[model samples]
Target: MLPQPSGPLRLAVGGLTSITDDFAFFTYNLCDYRRTGRSDEARYARVEEVIRELVRPGTPTVGAVQELPGDDWTSAAHGLGHLASATGLHCQAFTDGTRSAAAVPGGHDCLGLGLLWSAEVDPIADTLRYISGGPLWHALVMVDLNVGGHRISAASYHAPPKAGRDRRTAEAGLVATTLRSHAGDGGEIWLGADWNSPSSRTTDGLYYDPDPTEMVTSADRQRWGDDLPEIGYRTDRTPDMIMADAGFRDAAVEYGAPWAPTTGHGPNDRNGPRRIDRILYRPAAAAPGGVA
Candidate 1:
């Protein structure tokens, strides 16, 4: 059994892309949205220190992390080690690419696996079906670290809007399928992502909707066709709605507001702000973190 800590365990899901030396990209707690990718170690270290000092202690956070190696997989592992060591935060990073660590990563408490699928039409449908239709979507072989008596299995992904509406809908369907597969479950599950759904909150002056009807530009229509079914078409619309249908509760909804703002990556879109990146929890046998 894992050592059950007395403090709260907080899980954070966000985007981290290392672009160049000293220039990096971050969303959520990390500042500058963009930074010198070369100094990711320094940048992330500072961020971790701030989080540790400002936020509650013993909060295990996992974000969508990217590592590009100038050499081989070994170099990648070394890079990851540097990040964890620098921050004094033990972490496990999972990436399908050779740039990931030597050890496998998965689940809530431990390093977790990351899955990526392309939008090529021929294999897209098959890939979606396989991941969601079985235990693969909720696979949590390594997340058993928390002593909370409840396990948290999480999956993070980005939907392909440029792939067209039909393709996007199919992907959303796969998300729905995964939710169904995990329904009536005892463990906790969270799916996080920058899903460019039609009902995304509007902000600033950039009126954007993932809706095909509103996207009448010839180029956009061709890319996002009219035939595809947008699971929901209003501001309240989202893939979470599908999860709700399958018995999951919106974690943000529990607070009557979202945790962050729209476009976790792009410029802050709204004057009022909105949260597109979501955290959904499956009904659990017992509360994991203890009453939010």
Candidate 2:
């Protein structure tokens, strides 16, 4: 179930067909510890501070948030509302990723995905849609927005974690197909996701080095059998490659040469540092629209 905005003020659509100035699009995985009796206020405050520091003042921003607290609609709404108020952003939609938890053996119990946008943009009526069709570990929630007057579709996705390379690649194909269908020929599309897999374009040699102790350990092989690869976890680039083949470009890669690691800084770091989180976009300039 998706949660409705409590009370968000929206602007009437009227502006140029394309944006001349810069805007911000950010993706974050707000590790779902709050559901396990952690303090929500402290976590929300820290997240708000990080967002404020990253997003420039007066810039229209859109955020794709993964791992909201709780699996139920009520808890998801509460978390979304709290974050929206804290960041002064409008709650667009929330999709419960744990709806099929009972069906998945040993799957996570509580996980949700959400989207938030600044007041400058208005959500296109009835454009919100959730992508499904495969064994997706988390929700791939998308919505069309009228940014000033330029329309674009954005999605928040989280690929399955741990020893699911085939599943991840399959899910990536589903995502790419869905985005291409929605965007059509000229529509712009933005996707922010914690892919849980290293990029195909990674120049970093550390990711390629075989380390047996990291993600796929002896215990993991014993449990899941010998089908798992030996080259550590998240080393497979097939998932990211699927996305690249669909015409999407990685934001971090386009911004510079060396990609910065987005995860493994926490105290519970297990897989070592890697740039698993990404913001990918399919420009409209590739088709009919002149804007990118």
Candidate 3:
């Protein structure tokens, strides 16, 4: 069952990647992602700080959070409770990942995609589904919302990686089809995504490696075209292109790049950051509105 936080959500979309579901997966990435990632607790603290500072006090928020934990650990419910307690706004999380106990070391009991939203967001009942069919990597969460008194449908998506370009395109197409269905039923659409590929927002405009066989000669690379295309793609297109064709605005066109790299630093110089996380939407046809 998808979460339907009790209240109203405003018209805005936000997305962030790799936030561990609570600290449940902390032990899994203690050395590699915890300490080596950001000096111990600093990474977790930063995400909390972000929610506290950016989410604010009296407005609705729609966050498409990637790398969320499954319900077995109580990540989504508790995460929503935490946000509500901190900001005085209703919050909830929705994910399609199943609840399973931890099966491997350095892994969470459950891990997948989710939507973090304030009660005002109004998620449609049973609107959560796995993209690219059942049991895939990402989930799509939808809300049939009324913003500025206009009924609309909004969605949060997390697309697969660059190597799986064609599949990601198919997933984007699925999302597009869904959005079109909503529109045909008299609803407009908005989308937020951790698209995992380059756009006009990325440091590089193109998404595909241009040449996969030469990029990384692993046995998997050799198997893309001849074998499972799901593992990777021999050819690809930028997800932004697909979203644009779907009639959503690339937020990058308005927000520009973040002032600095989003990750990898030794106290100062940042690594090559990419603008893979983004918001896309078709503005309500009647009025030009701001992200409130």
Candidate 4:
């Protein structure tokens, strides 16, 4: 179950001296370094290079990252610290959601979730919260930030890759509901995630129409069973739909690049190509031109 807010939480104020309305948000699924052939140093350097290329100087930026190399909090913090140094951003690692206690090695908690933000953003005191129960496959880290004097609720999430549609839908529902509760009416919210599912609706074949045979395999069928398609692997867009129904907008689609692929690059192309990683946001209803 998601934690409920006890009362009106006070918003943190006035720490940023160079606050700006222009905010740049990004999400990335850094595949577990242990599974790849690249050395830790090489992988870290590549990640830093990619992020630096993506970030625009002088703009407030927030990056939500998944699959950070770490089995425990100490290791994850160390990894996040390296990223912070490389990217010049403040960092925080989400506790491993796969575990009932503090983040420790030896389960599905090997890969972790994290958040990185530029100095222009101020995180509210006691606002950092994690989703408990529902046994989320990966962590969902949520925090409230004072961005240019506007209170915004932001989160980083990574949905289960091997779970069934029902499980994924439930997880998405949990995330949406929890975010809405934290944001309240007319508040802005941002979520960056690797949903491990397609963004296109089943009925819509215009955007993404990958050959199911190339994506799904016998192993997938044996694992997911009835949750998969009768012939091949297909991710029903129910998870993304849940976010849409909650009033969040897919940032890529909104920016006119709905078909841009975020995954299945290089050696990780076993599942073909997909736009699974995303940055979704809900603008404040009362804001004058709205915040993205």
Question: lDDT by residue for model 3 over 1-292, one digit each (tens)?
Answer: 1112222222211223211111000001111222112244565455455555545333455454444433323553444344345534443323354332111111222333444444444444434433322433445655554333345565655565444445776677778787777654334565666665545333346432222333334332322324454554333334567777667755445333333222222343121243445556665555433331
TM-score, cand. 2 vs. native: 0.74
Model 4: number of clashes?
A: 0
Candidate 2: residue 25 Cα off by (Å): 0.6
Q: Rate the local accuracy (lDDT) of all candidates.
A: 0.35, 0.61, 0.42, 0.61
Model 1 CA deviation exceeding 4 Å by range = 1-55, 59-83, 93-147, 161-165, 179-184, 198-238, 258-260, 264-274, 286-292
lDDT of 1 at 128: 20
Better of 1 and 3 by lDDT: 3
The count of residue-pair clashes in candidate 3 stands at: 3
Q: Which tens-of-lDDT digit does each residue in 1-292 have in candidate 2? A: 0111122111111000111135667788777725546676775567676655555466667777777764565666677667777777887532352221111111244667677788876676656777432357666778877665677888888788764556888889989998888767677888888887666654344433122234445422212223335443324677888998988877655544343456555666555555567778888754344223
TM-score of 4: 0.75
The predictions' CA RMSDs to the true structure, in order, are: 12.6, 9.7, 10.6, 9.6
Q: Which stretches of candidate 4 lie over 4 Å from their true place?
A: 1-21, 33-38, 92-109, 132-134, 163-166, 201-231, 287-292
RMSD of 2: 9.7
Candidate 2's clash total is: 0
Of 3 and 4, the candidate ahead on TM-score is: 4
